[model samples]
Every structure is written in C-alpha cells, then in structure tokens.
Target: MPYQWPTLTNWLEQIAQPFYQQGYVILEQAIPADLCWALYQDVQHQQLTAAGVGRQGQHQLNQQVRRDHTAWLNQNNPVQQQYLQQMAQLQQDMNRRCFLGLIDFEAHYARYQQGDFYQKHLDAFVGRSNRVLSTVCYLNTLEQGGELLIYNEQDQLISRVQPNAGTLVIFESCRFPHEVLPATTTRYSIAGWFRQNSSIQGRIDPPQ
Candidate 1:
C-alpha cells in the first residue's frame, strides 16, 4: 500500500502528545516494510564515507550514511520518491502539531555488522540549533544483539527498543543518551534529527 498521508498525520498526533510529556514515543508499523528495505539497499550501494567518532565499534555504510544525509532527500527513484515525500510531509505536520517551530528531516542510513555499534551520545549539540527531536525507523528486523538503548543524563536505561521493521522511534534530540548495541548480523536504519534555528546552537564538537 502507498504511504497514506492523512492516516499518518492522525497517528503522528496520537504519538506526539505522549512524546511531549515523556520526551519520547514509538509508533509501530509506521512505514511499509518492503520500501524501507529498498531504500536501505539504495543507500548501501551509494558511496558512503566513514562516520567516525560520532559512531562506535565497527559501523560501516555507504556515503549517504557517512556524511550529512539531507542532501539526498530528492534523489530517490520514482516509487521511493513517494515514500520520501510522505516522510517529509509527516515531519512537517509533526512539527506544527508539537508546536516545535519548523522541523527539517535529514535522513540517514546506518549499516552495522558483527560487533558494530554506536557509542552512547546525544543527537544534536554543537553547530546545530533548534534540533528538538530525533527519529529512527528500522528498515529490517535483525537476528540478535542490536537494540536502541535510550538513557538519561545519569546513564539510567529509560527505554530499550528492539528492531521492528516499519516501526518508528521518536525522542528528544538533546536529552537522550542513546547508542546502538553491538550487532550480531547486519542491521539497517534511517536515522535523522529535527532541528530549529536556535541562536545559541553551539558549534559541532566531537563527542567527548
């Protein structure tokens, strides 16, 4: 089925309320499983630069996954183009409903194989302002050992989200200390952030 905009908008509103109160929300079966897999392949085939430091363990993916990924927002093939547009519209509605100003969706594909992981870190800090939210939609289900762990500032495990193809994980961009658990098999995800124009948005500093 094609991505349904009106239905998605309603779903976003339902999820956004709790997100505002608790700082995160999860939507199950939010996107088509097959389309998500296709986009993952397209990203894997594209040239990827290394995403060092910001990542951990042995993460590997093509160029789109490595650099600032918003540049490829419009490069999808026709069918995938529809999916991308729906995502963009959903993002816009989410921002308006949440009263978070304007939100820009910067999509990224992450590929992690055996022992690959991303160290615990916040989504946006330096060089970006108004980054109020972070979202990740799983492309496929993994065999084992890959989990999205959300932590508080004091390092308490607030939530642990296992991969469910088509489900979306939404959270505050600044408060969560999150990381990808080491992957036993290859894992794919579309990871991105929503940012506003904060005058105090600091310069991009490497994770300490």
Candidate 2:
C-alpha cells in the first residue's frame, strides 16, 4: 500500500519537534514500499561508482543530478515525478518556516552495502550556502546494521536512525555530525541537500 502524506500543517508540526530537540526527525513509512523498491531498481540500473573521498573519512558512491521546476515536471514516470514534487514542496515549506529564502534541491542516490559505511561528519561545506538541510529518503531497509549514528558536540552518541524503507529523515545540514554503521545488507537511499540560495549550487565556502 502507498503511504499517504499527512496534512502539510500536521506534518510540519510533528517534524518541528524532532528538528529542534534532537537535530533530526524521521518520518516512518513516508513513501510507498513498492515505489521505494522501484526507485532503488532504477538507481541500480543507473549504477554510478561511489567515487570521491567524503569529509567523514569514508568512501561513498552517489549520483548527483540537478533539477528545477520545469525539468522535473517533464519526467515520464508518474510515481517518480510525484516523489520529486513532494520533495520540492518539502524543501519550499522548510525554507519558508525557517525564514530562509528560496533554495534548490540537489538530488542524488546513496547506496551502502555490506562493508560500506560513511564516517561521522557534518553535511554542510565550510563556506557554501548550498546545504541547509540534510534530507534522506530510504529506498530499502536492511535486515541488520546500517543505522545512522548521530553524535553530540562532545562526540557522544545522541541518537540512531535505523534503516527503514520508505522513511524520510530530515536534519540540519551542518549542525549534526552522523555516520552509517556497516551494512549487513544493502541499504538504498535518495540523499540530497536543501539550500538557502539556489544561485550557488554546491561547494561550501572556506573558513576565513
């Protein structure tokens, strides 16, 4: 069965609690399980290598794609397009509520299988305004491991997000540092950044 989105206002209220208290929130069963699998299949078909060293000191394989209003609308698949639209709305709503101006979404795929995990690190680049929110939609759940570990400023474990397909987890882009535990099974997710300004896409600014 497809997961129905809560009333926009209701979801907003519910999400805000976690956002402020824990620095992250997870919407369980946010997406349809079947659709999640289909999307994962599509990503596998697209199959890009997990190149590049992440600041977290771990390797990651991702496919980053840029899409705006019109371009995303032209996509052929209804389900896929709906997903994108919802994501767009999510970004817009968050921006407005946070008193941040218009922002862009940088879409991408993140896959971690057995032996693959990302080290703990913040999402925002040093000087870039491109990452304001860290949003991840899980495509498939793992039977074991692959939980997202979030730590406090003192480097103490604060909270852990277990791998659950169809779940959407949101958090501040740079505030919380997190990492993925080694996956016992394959974990698929659509991970992306929501920025405050669309003018400059990626890349954070350097420290002064």
Candidate 3:
C-alpha cells in the first residue's frame, strides 16, 4: 500500500515547537521510504538541466559559485504528486501554528556532482523575496562531505547537517546563511520553498 502522509500523528505539535523557537525544524524520514526510492529512480532517469540562480528573467548559471543540475518536480509523476500533497498538509499546519500565511510551494530535484559546492548565501531577503521557508530532503547518502553548513548573524557556524538519505531539513529562508561543502561523491536531494501570497499589478511574487 502507498503510505499516506501526515502520519507523524503529532506532527503539527512536533514541527511547530522547534520552528517557533528557532525558526527551523528537521523532520527525519518524514516521507515513506518507498516514495523516496521512487523519486530517486526518477532522478536517475531524468535529464536534469543546469541549475541557475536569481529569478526568471535575471537567472544566471555561474559554475564558479555553484555547480548543480536540477529538474523541477512534475505533478504527472505519481510519487511527486504524493509528496506534494503531504507538503501541502505541512503548509497548512505551519500556517496554523506559525501563522506563516504560506500560499504554496515549489520544489526541484538537485544533483551536486563531486567537487560541486555552493557558496554561502541566503535563500530569502526578508522584504525582497516571497520565499518564507526553505526545505531540503536528502535523496541519497554520502560517506563524507556534502554537508550543509548554516551560519548565524555574526558569521559564526551554527549547525552542520550531513546529507543522509531520508533526512529532511527545514529552516527560515531569510535568517540563515548556508552553503554546501564539496563532497567526495555526488549528492542528490530535493530543494524547495514555501511561499506567501504576495502579488501585485497582476504579477505573482516569484512569477514561477
């Protein structure tokens, strides 16, 4: 049977506590193993495009700064749709507890080849970007490196998250400056963001 989500039973309370206190939460193996494996299979077969930075019109691919291939999750994929549905539930629960006003979500599969690393950067810029929360779910395990290093306001390192398969990491988009350390092996994961509804003049905040 396909495992249904929101199965943490007390997920709302569990996710809310840490998020409210620290503006972040990590849920381990939150999605079923079968789903994770299925998504991994899709990534193995899909043709990922060069990952870029910035918005739609201003996007750029700077290999010196970051090197990763990405493939956007498509709803036509049953596994992806299942994951999205669970995330939708999580969005609702988060809004209820944190009053985040999250309108929707967007995610993509990211593959970081060996030696590929992302320089320190913030996912959101408070009044500038609409992305409120950032999420990364590891799709494969690594023996060494490819760890996520999160920094604080004083430029001090706070946490080092290992890229363990089935591990889920969530954090505030604007508060943390994070980077991916070069790995000895390829790293696979799903990167996503929860956004608030901030539209004006008929243009969406992110515009896709």
TM-scores, each model vs. reference: 0.75, 0.74, 0.91
Which of the predicted structures, 2 or 3, would earn the higher TM-score when compared with the native? 3
Q: Which sequence of candidate numbers ranks them by TM-score, best first?
A: 3, 1, 2
Tens-digit per-residue lDDT, 64-84, candidate 2? 311101111224666566677
Candidate 1 residue 154 Cα shift, in angstroms, is: 3.3
Instruction: Give the C-alpha miss distance for residue 80 in model 2, angstroms.
Output: 4.1
RMSD of each: 6.1, 6.8, 2.9
- What tens-digit string does per-residue lDDT give for candidate 1 at 129-189? 4566788887677757779999987889998898877778988888888988887887777
lDDT of 1: 0.67
| RMSD score of candidate 2 (Å) | 6.8
Q: How many clashing residue pairs, candidate 2?
A: 5
Error of 2 at 177 (Å): 0.7
Instruction: Please give the lDDT score at residue 166 for candidate 3.
Output: 70
* Candidate 3: tens digits of C-alpha lDDT, residues 1-208: 3323443556556778898998777777666777777777778888899888888888899888789889888789888898788789889999987899988799999999989899899998877888889999888878888999989878899889988777788899989999999977989999999998666864658633
Alpha-carbon shift of residue 196 in model 3 (angstroms): 0.6
| Per-candidate clash tally | 11, 5, 0
